[model samples]
Target: MFTTKDATTPHVGLLVDKVEDNVDYKKEDIKPLDKLTEVGFDIDPQTKNMMRGLIKLAEKHSVLIDPSAIFSPVHIAQEDIQESEAYGLF
Candidate 1:
């Protein structure tokens, strides 16, 4: 997942499995996951810090998991997003 500040609201972006035209296209030829925002996980400051620690530990041990498994799309409040942005955290 990735975060973007381009929009007026703060939201998370997710990378989904690749969709095939024959199998996954919607009525207008849009992919199933395209522009979809079903749920969100809010990452508070403490949680973010904890996650950072966990990542550090994993790196130290050389057991870091794949990035794709780490997080889902999260929708944080504007203020929190701003704070996170200030720290260049994602």
Candidate 2:
């Protein structure tokens, strides 16, 4: 997993699936959302500002999550809600 410090909060952390040597992406491939609500995230509008955008990879899709959002308690709580709602059986 990838780990990094949060820009907005000193005590919080930013974690991801994998950390690699930084890769480059085309400008056009990066799609921005006006708000986190576009992705069903129920976070504060302030936290929503941390969302960078989405990156298209072949036929798959990936999100460009901001370190600030990753470190946000509100964002984390919203994610937990989504995850549990999607897979309560686990």
Candidate 3:
């Protein structure tokens, strides 16, 4: 979620829900989602564009059906955990 090459602030940060406390961040402890939303991210514009493209593809293919509905903080974590366990993302 971050890189030394990150611009403006070579730091990667995120705001998560209270359940975020249950996750292993590998470094910093979890912070509330409101914090993350407020702190936000400063990813490279190129990466943002690339992500937009990928999101578009997913939306068009129904790969992320009702994505907004599943966008709940808890579900986001679940999706990541599932994908990691399923494909050894950990």
Candidate 4:
């Protein structure tokens, strides 16, 4: 499982069969998921919200999960929601 946490959100993790190097890819390397490609995958609403797009890594096409999406299901107090220039990047 891979776990990630952000300053504004709780920690989130996902179970995986294996792990690989933390590499980067160019924007053009990613493709949007089509309906056919999404079939049979029972994605939770929260999980779906976390999906960014599809990207090709090596020879395999993979789902690119956004870090922000991991915390989509979390409920924050209204008072906890603060606006700051630091957060504008997200």
Candidate 5:
């Protein structure tokens, strides 16, 4: 979920689900998207448009969003890696 330096808006948003009634949520629970990339996540361009639409809808409803919660993590598929190397994009 990493973004280019000039990106004006995020291309994705995280949707965290809660399970435990007594669970405590902290800012630390949400890892920075850039850091996730170092750990093997990749930017999924296919989701960009969907995320933009969701964000726009949320804005229209006056929803307050945490900047840190805007990007979601996704694993980099082996196939994608091979493709990138093949095309010299990695």
Candidate 6:
């Protein structure tokens, strides 16, 4: 909704339905919405295994990944990208 309309972002040719721009001073000015996104997440036998792989990959680039909320993972991992492991059922 922001990219296609907001002049701050470039035109990415994304398809969006509608946008609301009413600044009515009501109960609240902004309404938060829960959005489900398809994201890549890894789960191993345990947290140790996960940390081992993370450490090994970090050693290659000599950088650590300490993620936090309010930031996108793509922004942090894009510089040192690695091919993801195959998806499977346990």
**Candidate with maximal lDDT:** 4
In order, the Cα lDDT scores of the candidates are 0.32, 0.54, 0.30, 0.56, 0.35, 0.26
Model 6 spans > 4 angstroms off: 1-11, 23-34, 38-90
Best by TM-score: 4
Write model 1 residue lDDT over 1-43, tens digit each, in one string. 4454554554444344443223322244332221222335454
TM-score per candidate, in order? 0.17, 0.40, 0.17, 0.49, 0.24, 0.17
| Candidate 3 regions with alpha-carbon error over 4 angstroms | 1-38, 53-90
Model 2 Cα lDDT, one tens digit per residue, 1-90: 223455443542334566544657898988776443576855555544555786776875556765544444554545543323533311
lDDT of 3 by residue, 22-84 (tens): 322322232323342254645454333223111112223111122222223433544644333
lDDT of 5 by residue, 1-90 (tens): 334324676544445442233433444344444443475756565433223211112223111232322332234332343323333322
How many angstroms is residue 89 displaced in model 3 relative to the true structure, after the best TM-score fit?
25
TM-score of 5: 0.24
Off by over 4 Å in 5: 1-23, 46-90
Order by TM-score, highest first: 4, 2, 5, 3, 6, 1
Ranking by lDDT: 4, 2, 5, 1, 3, 6
Write the residue-wise lDDT of candidate 4 on 1-90 in tens digits.
433455655444455655555658889887775542566656655556567787777886667766443433355522354444643212
Candidate 4 TM-score to native: 0.49
Candidate 6 lDDT over residue span 8-62, tens digit each: 6553232333333432333332222111112343332322221211211222311
Where does candidate 6 have its weakest 10-residue lDDT segment? 61-70
lDDT: the better of candidates 3 and 6? 3
Query: For residue 54, what is the lDDT in candidate 5?
Result: 15
Q: Which residue pairs come into collision in candidate 4?
A: none
Per-residue error for 43 in candidate 3, Å, reads 1.1
In candidate 5, position 63 carries an lDDT of: 19
